[model samples]
Target: MEPDHEVLVVGAGFSGLCVGIRLRRKGVRDFVILDAAPSVGGVWRHNTYPGVAVDIPSATYCYSFEPNPGWTRSFAPGAEVRAYAEHCADKYRLRPHLRLNTRVERAVFDEDADLWRVATTGGEITARFVVSAVGPLDQPKNPDIPGIDDFAGTVLHTARWDHGHDVAGERVAVIGTGASGLQVIPELAGKAAHLDVYQRTPIWVFPKVDFAIPTPVRALFRIAPPVQRLVRLVTAAASEVIMVLGIVHYSKVPFLVRAVEALCRAHLRRQVPDRALRRALTPRYGFGCKRPSFSNRYFPTFMRDDVDLVTTPIDRVTPKGIVTADGREREIDTLVLATGFKILELGAMPPFPVVGLDGVELGAYWDEHRYQTYEGLSVPQAPNFWLMNGPYTVTGASWFSIIEAGATHAVRCIAEARRRRATRMTVKRGPHDAFTRDMRRRMRGTILAQPSCARSNSYYFDRHGDAPYVRPQSGLHVWRRARTFDLDDYSYGP
Candidate 1:
């Protein structure tokens, strides 16, 4: 069968939208965008957990195309984010070309014709190029706690909050101390009759300092995106740079992490007042070993007389509630799990299979090491396939900026390919080997490399201290490299 479109975008989020817009801007509209959800917003549509909001300022969180002058808050909420994505789709006129409710099951590359044959739940479609903008956090992962199914009352992951479930005045148990858990716990504290916060380790929390984006500020943003974007860039840079000292070189620069952690510990001590609870909630691991989170309200929630912080490991769950390995059983009517997404699960690596230069399946090779893509976009053997928000593309700043940078790179590659009438092009193994070695070399004393970090088996994983996935540098450096799109790094075939 013949191909369906020139380009097949596997998401309708900011990245996919940007890719579509860039294609249109270059006068190429023969693209089709497919999303499993019935609407445009991907993660934003699903993650409506309590107190959910972006930490980044509104300007950086938004698209470069359609800026909403009416941002009520400095850090936009879920609804506003969804609205912004929808608004951008409308502004760029990308909705007409998007197919909602279409779940991509698999996409295989046809070596002979050099096309991507994407099989969705609905049907099959093909395109010469495939853009996987499926952000890492899009897939919700359920914790594998034994006997969780036997829980008679309610169970829901934070990313897939069940609005219909009445959590008010009910006894609740929340598992996992990740970012999602930290964000949602505070919101649930007051409402639940009693709340049990199960923690393997405590997370580093700082003040959010969130504020309203007054009407005047919104007006300025809408009227001047360029100025707003500039300010956004500067602020994001400032924030990210401060954080770098604590994360990338934690051992060399222990003072900042210690200082910030001390501040958080002090915050907890002041709020909780009870030394026992404070001790239970205090983080033992090196600060910044895991992702650092911020919240004005999280510490205060623990002060509530009804909340309990259980640091003990779980043995199993009963028909009623959880049983800690310490031989204590705590019963609860509801379970709110915040165990974030499957960070390790790369959806069908190769994602689109590669019949490489040697006809070896790139999928099989990447299986040995979660997915390996050069520059987190192009694999060594995959031609004309780009992954947005792929491995290491995630940023502490704004993920949207990463998406924008990638879109820029993708368009440049597409333009060159069209110009040369190239049937296929793949990043050479030499460039990828050089880049990966450099990236891992720079990862040495970073948070992901600590001996204490090595001891822990949490999601802040480095393969029990062997393999690495997280990037070692700042997003700005990533942006600089991504913007370049070095054609020399790739080998082309006609």
Candidate 2:
């Protein structure tokens, strides 16, 4: 049977956009980009909190092919990132292929027809190939605290911020001090009449080197694209060094982690004078165990007279406010949940039910056997299906690096299938197992395998005590491997 389209891309975010762009470039035009949101940009489009901005420098946060010279700051704000996504969509002429406000429910492979019958909100759509670009962080995870719904006061989630709600002059409480909490806490300190910061675990905070780009620099970048490329190279190299030494090569170069931890300690000492507060703010785990955040104002904000860091464990939420484990209750007018997205969970990995070959459910299989993939792109039985972001795929500090690598890998496979005039292209079990074994072997050298990481409360390590989220390789190595991997690893047939 002929398919509805040649390929059906599952998302319209950075991953989906990159895949769509690469597909078009490969002369494969029969495809559509579907997104659940009203517009494109994925997380950038959804997350619009007050202090939302890229944690990394703007130079390394963008695509290599498309660099914006008009960034106002070295670390561009969330709006600018969203605008950049929109710019990419428009420039690449992806607007015509986009189906907005469409959510994919399930996708089942038809063995006889050798195609995917996808079920989305809009109805059924079939394709010869299905690319699951739905990112890991697409679904927000709300804390399962008792009586959370019983709160009569105004409630807000960092991901789904309400623009009309005013927090000024109101008593506010922000829960969970992760990346979003780090950014929003500083912005909420002075604005709210009184702010209470609930902390389950303290994170390593580094001073962010953020500043505005001068007009002259912008002009130079625009006129001489090579200059911007040079800047990207330097920034990317710096990020790669941190990922390699502080994370991947932690066992070999433990001093790098100590140096970084010392810097963070100094930064904390300089910002917070109270010794007790400093002790409460320090993390017991290793530096690279959990994803560390960078912020100039996060630590300093704790010093504000109006802002009080509540280290006591939360017992439950009442209609008036939150009640601590020690029986201390704080009455507040508003509650802001800074709880982050679901990263390692089964629901997050696929975001929906995906039935592959022989009645195997993708999420169930991973949950039972452990999450493993071939180069984080293909599974053994899941023919004609590719995941742009999968287990053991994330390489560099910049997410763009992973997207580029995964896109190149997937597009290469698809191109090979076309070359062979094949309808089915599945990764061989032998190669997939070999790659998974190698990844696990390399993971032992990383910080995630350390005993101290057990206290990290990090989403990086799954329930199986394995850190499959990172590829344990440098960005350059991952990129090179993606391009030069042998096509014989996959089996092509009619």
Candidate 3:
């Protein structure tokens, strides 16, 4: 058997890119990075909708090692973020090791051989270690509404923004008011002659304190690590307030939660003077449910004369427009589906078929609630296979932090594999089960599972019906957990 390299990193997005970068620093250059797309930036590259920008401040949205002193906007847009990823790849000279436009079809852990046999849409590759950083938000999800395909007009998911399609002066139907819709609607509001937003459930919206990071301020931060760290700390602390009120206190909605709900209501009422329409747009859920967005401009978009909020259920799509269950017909040419991604399929398995240990399909293994892995990194039954950003790892804060954490964890696992001189390693069943169960128990106590949690379709849950992706605590906790690894927690077999 030949080694594709010491490691085969899946996905060239932030997670995989960071993993490859750190692995290179550790002097392991014999690795390859694969991505389904033709370039980097992952979600940022794909989600190029109008008004697409980071909800979080730009102060903390970067690598701990490298800081940018020239972000034009405080809340940088998609292009800047994508450019940052591209810069990282170029600065680190990571393109040569990257194989773009190649998708992994399948990967199987050969227990006896002690290696992962990897197959791709391009070709087969063997590696001593396989790192999955495919990302949690790469695959766009379409709503289960019947005839979504039957829409005679152009239907586009936010991720796959159709640059070629024109919505100008045309009537449009925007489905789903989640983060994507919030960003796109405001940009599309004035363009479309008439816009109808079919919102199933109202979402918690807060004002985005977005501003510009002046060049002097950026220069100051470039030299002073303390300033940047302080900014990150403040933002982290503010985000933590929501986590405390929502995640820890799952039972009751706190008073601040009430205040936020009221504030959002007031904003809606103030912007859209029509009492009837304002009443239709107010959210019934708590502020922190469903990853509340901060947008100072989102609500005002609804106030536009041409914009209308429709809470009615959709019967189906006709040739020219959407027919609501209430029997109203809204004619539209373009339909923008702001529905989210298939998050579970993100750390996507290979395209062919992955048979782990005893000829078991990887998908079925997870389906049986046995997607066991140590620290959500490596499976005991699966040799030389690793998952990054796999489970219980989403941070409302910068995912740059989580990606680095996962990268740190992956580097450690690779080091352990090297030290053991083993062809592959898998976490033992007992520990894997224990950790996963502990994660669930912790999450159930979070605001994410509360009764007021997002009634809308969210990709936060796994098949086992658990908040398997969100980190229930601090970003620092994740960093610390990934930085330090205990081999005893995992069983190493050759």
The clash count for each model shown is 0, 0, 13
Query: How much lDDT does each candidate structure score?
Result: 0.76, 0.91, 0.77
Score candidate 1 by lDDT.
0.76
TM-scores, all candidates, are 0.93, 0.99, 0.93
Q: Identify the runs in model 3 with alpha carbons over 4 angstroms from their true place.
A: 249-256, 259-263, 345-353, 370-373
Where model 1 places Cα greater than 4 Å from the true spot, the runs are 346-364, 369-371, 455-469
Give the winner by TM-score: 2
Candidate 1 lDDT, tens digit per residue, 1-494?
34678788888877788999999999888898889888988888889998888766776777655556767887778888888888888888998889999988776778888887778888889888888877667777777889989999899899899888979999999998777888889888989999999988777676676898777777777787777878777877866765567777676888877788888887777677778877776777777667767777777777778988888899999999999999899999999989887655434333444444346566566656645567777776667788786655555556676788788877777777777877677778888787777766766877766776653445545333433446667777777877775887877776
Model 2 clash pairs are none
TM-score for candidate 3, residues paired by index: 0.93
Pitting candidate 1 against candidate 2, the one with the higher lDDT is: 2
lDDT (10s digit) by residue, model 3, range 48-117: 9888988778877888787766688878898999999999999997998999999887887766567777
Candidate 2 per-residue C-alpha lDDT over 122-171 given as tens digits, one digit per residue, 9 for 90 to 100: 99999999899988778878899999999999999999999999999999
Model 2: ten consecutive residues of lowest lDDT: 393-402
List the candidate numbers ranked by lDDT, top first.
Answer: 2, 3, 1
Against the hidden true structure, what lDDT does model 2 obtain? 0.91
